[model samples]
Target: MTQAQQLREAILAAPLETSNFGETPQPGTLYLPLSHLKALRLDAHVVVGGRGVGKSFWTAALQSEPLRRLLGLAASELKGMEVHAGFSIAEHIDNYPNADVFDAFLAEGGDPYDLWRAVVLRWIARQAGKIIPHDSWPHTVAWLKQNPEDVARLMQQPRNWKGLILFDALDRTSADWRRMDSIVQGLLRTTLWLKAYPGLYAKVFLRDDQAERTVFNFTDASKLTATKAELKWARHDLHGLLWQRLINAPDTHGEILRDICRSTQQENVWHVAPEMKSESDPQRKAFETLAGPWMGRDKRRGVPYTWSVSHLSDGRGQTSPRSFLAAIRQAAEDSLERYPSHEYALHYESIKRGIQKASEIRVQEMAEDYPWVPKTLAVLSGMNVPMDFDIVREKWENAPAGALEGNPTRLPAQHIDRGWDGVREDLQRLGLLETKKDGRIDMPDLYRVGFGLGRKGGVKPKG
Candidate 1:
């Protein structure tokens, strides 16, 4: 076999892992996008980002002592801190309230602030060997609220350790948007409440929409909001993350990647050779080593590095690390299967197919979080975007009542009662849809490709 064939097979065999939802991230795979550095700060109480932008990933990573130590190198303040989970979707249901229980608590006029404090109190109680009402949120809340003086005394009596409690996937706490918002608000309120104590802190991972909503309506919501840090991926960060994973591949694949990648003393800190000046520049060289820079043999088709990322961006020009990795993984699989004899491991066409795959995964994730969004957007799959607002509204208006079920995520029925315009506004707010300067509707490539929508001059994927 030729060197190209060896490279192709190695690429085919390389492990391209994505989705940090349920598993503990390996220390080697933890590439901190510079934007996430703020999130690792002990004082950054609230971290916000869109889906697949490391909310759950950071949540899980912070819990691991090894990862925390590694992370501390960048955020020195995180050193010597104990980490706990106040709430998480990946955690056992018993650890936090489920949907029915949360609703019931709200029905009884129970405040989410009290519920969140109960969660904190339980964590404190566990540390102090004081057993509280662990079985019931109501009982726990009542106990925590009734014993404010005791709770204050207990908090003040803390030992030699400083600690951080993490909250992630707040959407799981309730299906109704209002309820979830309230729960998140309460959690933030609790975060502020914890601030009075010197050694204790809370970190919340919230969705962008959740952070932008009325969840921060309280008097000092600004305190938590002031410390908010966004989890964004720069173009260079995505490339750095890709090489980091590629060089860490197992066996012969790892050997080949390490030979090409420049390394730091840290076990998996992979980078292009020192000749590459910028973070984005190394990515181009590293990717060129695999796919020879261009999408094809010529420049007209596009550069894989630019085209791949440009095609995955949301309406706001944000491209997530998850989608970028997914696209590359799918590109490799497609190239090996369809263009085994191609000069590079990944074919340009294969990369386009990868975008489609990434889009599908993104869409599915969106549906899981906002269940009604897919059905709502399905009405316009084949229609070209930048079309008139009235045209889009007509499509939504003509959509059947059964087709318009908007409560799948159990968000409040605010949109269900409102008309198509309201739905349009909500989609825009979520960064799924945007209005062009021409007063027409536009969906971002992050969402458009999976929905089977097409752009006039965009890279087209084969069916």
Candidate 2:
């Protein structure tokens, strides 16, 4: 068997742990299947990624049995650990039957630091199978209010607690945008406060946009950047994931995975047939030469390649393993639905068609929440098209004269500005855009992959 096939066989035969293949999967819901957890062991770090990238999955996977084993904790000893894993107290304050707690605390008008201390103490007490004594809680609250230094001292006392507190969905808070500054301030404060406590670590998952709007002011990039882990996919990681899924899947469908991967390489050749000019582009010639034997294509067609090699080379090829796996899952589902009886014989064309359909589905899903998705995707598709605030503003102004005639309330110019702002926010949230020192927005290599755009300084595709 070929080396690729041998690798595939080895992965298939290995015992699998998780099915999640994304950056931030939902916590307690999706499991992030990554081999890196073996490295993390019992350490704490911030996981940063866009929505649906698999942050929660990674967090949840860390709580899995294999991880606890790595950390030397028995299953029974980790009972209360799950309580510490969730978003801010605001999300779960209602679950606390003591309405008086919020009323009294808010009435006293304490800084967020004090308020968080009270809430956390109460949460911990509750998790330990004991309620905070009603009378003692008030005294503790008063003590916290009177002696902030004492509270800090008490937080330093190392307890036997051996689990992590995961703060997720910070971007999902319903707080007004104007309040973003204070909200982020409170979050960072809580992180710092929690970190001081012994045997307690907090993991705050945030999107890049939310980080900019909230956490950027309080914490320096160097400090937070070291703790930050971006949720992009590496090609080998993608391959491992696919192999794991194929191996663990029912034996009936096992061969299909290998066939699909092999066929995808073939279909890519056909799709980019026109772009393979040997004489005019020697680099293209070399790439084709390397890929030709596997791709089964001898000549360079004028058609452009769908995947960007330069971006992949820079280690930001795909947005996340989630995107790659989502595409595969969708294609597989489509194949089974279309030809259930003989899905094993699924043609390469069917999978390619499924990928196109899946891409549209993914776009539509994101667009539901983000209105400017279509335009942002269009911009990405328009390779060599410079994107800046001025360019975006011009596009809004020059939109066909009749485009905004129907909506009397929505002025074309105003709508254009809104669209630009929305796109910027959405892209930043998705980690597709980053702000430079000069405040100009730049697209990352991961974003270029879907649009077939090259990396910085790479060859631009002909329009």
**Deviation (Å) of 312 in candidate 2:** 11
The top-ranked prediction according to lDDT is: 1
TM-score each candidate.
Answer: 0.94, 0.58
Candidate 1 residue spans exceeding 4 A from truth: 265-280, 407-409, 412-418
**Candidate 1: deviation at residue 366, Å?**
1.5
Can you write out model 1's per-residue Cα lDDT over 266-315, one digit (the tens) per residue? 53444333333236555577778777778767898888878889889988
Error of 2 at 440 (Å): 15
Per-residue alpha-carbon lDDT of model 2 for 53-103, expressed as tens digits? 556565555555544433333233444455354453233542221334434
Which window of ten consecutive residues has the lowest lDDT sum in model 1? 269-278
Error of 1 at 395 (Å): 0.9
Deviation of model 1 at 340, angstroms: 0.8
- Candidate lDDT scores, in order, read 0.78, 0.44
Clash totals, every prediction: 2, 16
